[model samples]
Target chain A: MALSAVRAPKIQLRQVRKVFDAHEQGMVALQNVDLDVSANEFVTLVGASGCGKSTLLRIIGGLEYATRGDVLIDGHGVLGPGSDRAMVFQHYSLYPWLRVMENIKFSRRLQANRGELTSSEVEAASGRADALLNVMGLSNAADKYPNQLSGGMQQRVAIARALLPRPQVLLMDEPFGALDAQTREVMHDLILHVFKLERATIVFVTHDVEEAIYLGQRVVLMAPRPGRIDTIYRVPLPAQRHQDMKHAPEFLALKREILQRIRETSGMKTDLELLEKLSHSVSISSLRTQG
Target chain B: MHNFSFSRPARRPAWFAVRGQIGRREYWMLALVGLVVPLLLWWSLSASGLVTKVFMPGPADVWNRAVLWFREDDLLGDIGISVYRVVAAWGLSALIAIPLGLAIGTYRPVQALLEPLTDFIRYMPAVAFIPLVMLWIGITEGSKIAIIWIGTFFQMVLMVAEDVRRVPMAQIETAQTMGARRSEIVSLVLLPAAKPAILDTLRVTMGWAWTYLVVAELVAANSGLGYAILRAQRFLQTDKIFAGIIIIGLIGLLLDQLFRALHRKAFPWLYLR
Candidate 1:
C-alpha cells in the first residue's frame, strides 16, 4: 500500500469573517481567522472578553454562521450542527428536569431520533454513558439532579455527557471559568486525562493564560477590538504534563510573553493607568469621609 | 472551660427580623393568628350592634345558616357544580393553550401571529362576553363554561408562552449541538426545561378561573355556588351570602393547596430543602 504524503486536517477554517448587523455599521466579531486542527490535537484559544474566541468556536460548531469564508470538517463544508461535533459550555447546560444519567443519555436519544443508531446501538450508548459516568467519578450522582450537585460536579456531568457520543471534535468554551481556583486545578488534570483516554481533537477557549498553557499543545492567542487571532505558540513540554510544570522556567517565560502580547493587543496598559488614577481618587474620597 | 451562658440565647434573634426563618411550630402559630384575628374582629363588630343583622351576619349565625343550607338545600351539589364548571373550563383551556403557547414560544412566526392577538383579547373582560356567550350557547352549562374559558384562556396562553420563553437559550443550543432534530428539541429540551414553570402557570391561571365563577353563573343558572350567592342576596339572606362566600374561599384555598402539593411532588428537584 502507498503511503499518503500529507494528512488532511480534521477541522479547518479558512479566511473566516463574522459581521453582526452587516447592513448597518457592522460589528466584526471575527476577521480573517485561519487555523487547522489535526486529528488528535489539543488547541486552546485565549483572549480578553470580546476577543471573538467564543464566536469563532461557535462558528466552527455551526451554532453560528460566518459571514464569509469556509469552515471544513473532514474536508466537508460545514453546515449546521452534526453528530461529529459536541460542545461543552461554561454554563453546566444540563437539563434540570433530567437526572445525571438521563442527561448523559440525552445525546444518545438525539442520535436515535435521527435514525443514526439502531436499537442495539441505542442500548450500547447507555452502557457507554455508564462507563463515562464512572470515568467522570459521578457514578454516585447518577440519579441526582443537576441542581443537587456542586458547580464542579455539574460541569463534570456535562463533560461526561459530551464525551458519551465520542464526537470527533470537542468544543469547550471555558468549561472551568466558573470554578474556584482549587477546583479549576483539579479539572485541568481531569480534562487532560479524558483527552488522552478519548483521543478526540479539542478546541478549548479560555481567558486564563495559565490554564491555556497548562492544557494546550499549541496556544492560539486572540485580540479584541474587531477580534482576530494574533499569535500561536507551541508548548515545549512533553506529551505528559505535571501540575508542577506550570512553575518551570520555559513555562513561565512563555506565559510572560503571551501575557505581555495580550496586554499590548487589548490596550491593558492605558486601562491600568486609568485604574490607578481611579484608586488614588477613591482613597482621597475615603479619607475625606473619615475626617 | 469557662462557664459563659446567656439567658434565652440572645432573645432568639428577634422573631420578626427581616428574612428570618421561623420553625414549623412558629409558622403554624402565626398562621393561626392570621385567621383568628380576622374572625375575632368580625365577631366583635357584629356583636357590638354597629350594623344591623340584615347587613352583617355574626359568625355563629353564618355557621348555623351554612349547616341549615347544607341539610335543607343541595349545598354539596352547588359546590360540586361550581367546581366542575371551573375544572372543565380550565382543563380545556390548558389543553388548548399549552400547545398553542409552546408553539408561539418556540417559533418566532407563531409568536408574531398570536401574541398580540392574545394580549388584545385578554383585556376584553370575560363578563363582557356574557351576552354573546348566552346568545351563542343559550343559557346552558356550555355558556357558563365558555364564559370561564373566555376569561382565562388568553391570559393562560400568554403566561405559558412566557414560561416556555424563559427556558434558558443555553439548553436549546446544547441540544442543537448534540444534533437534535427540531421535534427532539421541542420534546426533549424545550418542554422538559419549561415544564415546572408551565405547571406554575397552570396553578395560577386556575385561581383566575375561579374569580369568574359569579359571572359564569350569572347567565340564568339555578345551580352552583355563584347562583346560590345571587339568590341569597335577593331575599336578604345575609347569613347565607356569608356562608356562600366562605365556602367559595375554602374551595379556592383547597384547590390552591392541592396545586402546590402537586408541584412539589412532580418536581422534587426544585424543592431541595
Candidate 2:
C-alpha cells in the first residue's frame, strides 16, 4: 500500500473486445481496445453514444466480461468482481432505501456482518461517513434518502459512496450526464477537488469532449463502428487550473481538435477552417493514427 | 439596450389546476366524509322503517346486542379466538413463504419446479379440502389452522416471489462489486430493496386470510365469532347476526390500519411521497 511501491499502471485493459449475442441480433461493442491507466491519473474516455466507452469501463469494474483479451489490475487477471474497484454509474446508483450517511458507509457495513458490528467498527465507519458528508457538502442531507434529494445531490452522494471504500481504481460511467447544466459545472469542480485530495486512480467515461479535456490529465477520444481508441490528447493545463482556463487559447485549441476528430470518426465532414486553427496551436499530436 | 413590453397573462379554470400530490391532511378530510356517509345512510333507512325489523335491525338494536354479547355472551372470548387463529395461520404462511419466494424468484430452476404447483393450489378452494384435512388431522384446531393455511399459503408465496423478483438487478450487481458474497446479496441488497413491497403483500394477504376465517370456523365443533354468528342464524336472531358482522368489519379495519401505520413508520422514505 506504500505510495512509492505502486509504480505501474493501476489498471490495464489489453486487446479487450466485447460482443452481445443475448439479443436476436448480435452486435460488437468494443474491439482491440488497449489502455494503460497509471496510478492517481484522471483519465477521461470521451466518444459518441455507441462508442463502447461504458462497456470498457464495465469490463474494468468487473460488471461485464470481455469477449476476448485480458483485464488486469496491478498485473493480475480479473476473475470476477472485486472490492478493489468501485464504480459510480450514470443512473445515480445510490441505494434508495439507505440514507446519505448509510449509503456512504455501505461498503464498510457490508464487510462486517450487520448484527455483529462492533462498537469500534461503527465509530470508524461513522467518522469516515461524517468526513465524506462534509467533503461532498452534504452534511445537511445526512439523514435524507436518495429519492428525497435532487439529481445533483444524489450524484454527489454516489461519488462519496464510491470513494468511501478507498478503492484502488474508481470507474465512473457518465456520472454527471443526468444533471442540469449548472449542476454539471459544480460537479466538474467537485470531482477535481476529490481527485486531488484522494489521489486515487480514476477512469471517467463521458461523451462530452470539453468535460473530458477540462478534468482529464489524458483525454482518450474513442470512435464507433467497432469502438476503438482513435486518439489520445494530453491536457496541457497547469496543476492549479480553474474554470476560466476553459477559455484559454491552449484549452480551446485542444477541444476544437478533439471535436473535429469526433466529427470525422462519426463520418461527418470536418470543416477545413476549424482544422487549420486546431493544427496551429497544439504541440502534442493526436498521435493515434489507426492502421 | 433592451425594451420591456407588458401583456395580459392567460388564465385557466381552478378545476384544471393539478397539484403534485394530495397531502395527508386533505386525504383524512375526504376519509371523514367517506366514513360518515355510509353509516348515516344505514341509520336513516333503519330508523325510518324503510327495511323491516325482521330483515334489518336498527342501529340501537345492534348496539344493545353488542353490549349484551360483550357483557354476558363471551363475545370477547370468541373474537379473541378468531384473531388468534388468523394470526397463527398467517404467521406460519409468512415464515414459509418469504424464504421459498426469495429462492423461487432468484433461481430459475427452483421457480420452474415450484411455480406450477403453487399456481394450481391457489385456485382450489380451501373449503374443498376441509374433509381431506379432517381425514388427515381430524376436525380439531389443526383442521381450522389447515384451512387457513390452504387459503393463504400459496397466494402469499406467489406474491412474495413477485416482490423479490421486482428488485432491481443493478442493485445486486452493485452489492457484488462492493465484495458482497452470494449470501450477503440476499441479506443486504435484495431484502432491503424489497422491504416496502413485501410489507404491502403481507398486509393484503392478511385481509384475505380474514375472509376465510368463518370457513375455517365452520369445520370446527365450537367457539370463534363465526360459530356464534352461525348459531344465531339458526335461531333467527338477526340482531345478533348484525352484531357479529359489525364486529368482524371493525376488526378487519383495525388490522388494516395497524399494517398501514407500521409501513409508514418502518419506511418513511417511501411514504414521504
DockQ of each: 0.69, 0.37
Please list the residue runs of candidate 1 whose C-alpha ends up more than 4 Å from where it truly belongs after superposition: A1-6, A113-116, A276-291, B1-20
Model 2 / residue B15 / CA error / Å: 8.0
lDDT of 1 by residue, B1-273 (tens): 233576535345567778988899989998999999999999999999999999999999999999998998989999999999999999999999999999999999999999999999999989999999988999889999999999999999999999989988778888998888899899988898889899989999998999899889999999999999999989999999999999999998898899899999999989872
lDDT of 2 by residue, B61-127 (tens): 9999999999999998999899998988999999999999989888889999999999998999899
True contacts kept of 2: 0.51
Q: Which ten contiguous residues of candidate 2 chain A have the minimum total lDDT?
A: A282-291
Which regions of candidate 2 deviate over 4 angstroms?
A1-7, A114-129, A143-148, A222-233, A249-291, B1-26, B231-238, B271-273
| Predicted candidate 1 versus true structure: per-residue lDDT over A180-252, tens digit per residue | 9999999999999999999999999999999999999999999998889999999999889899999999999
lDDT, candidate 1, equals 0.91
Cα deviation of B17, candidate 1, in Å: 5.5
The true-versus-predicted C-alpha distance at residue B91 of model 2, in Å, is 0.5
Pairs that collide, model 2: none
- After aligning candidate 1 to the native by TM-score, how far in Å is the CA of B79 from where it should be? 0.9
- Per-residue error for B272 in candidate 2, Å, reads 5.6
Whole-model alpha-carbon lDDT for candidate 2: 0.87
What is the overall TM-score of model 2 with all chains considered together? Answer: 0.83
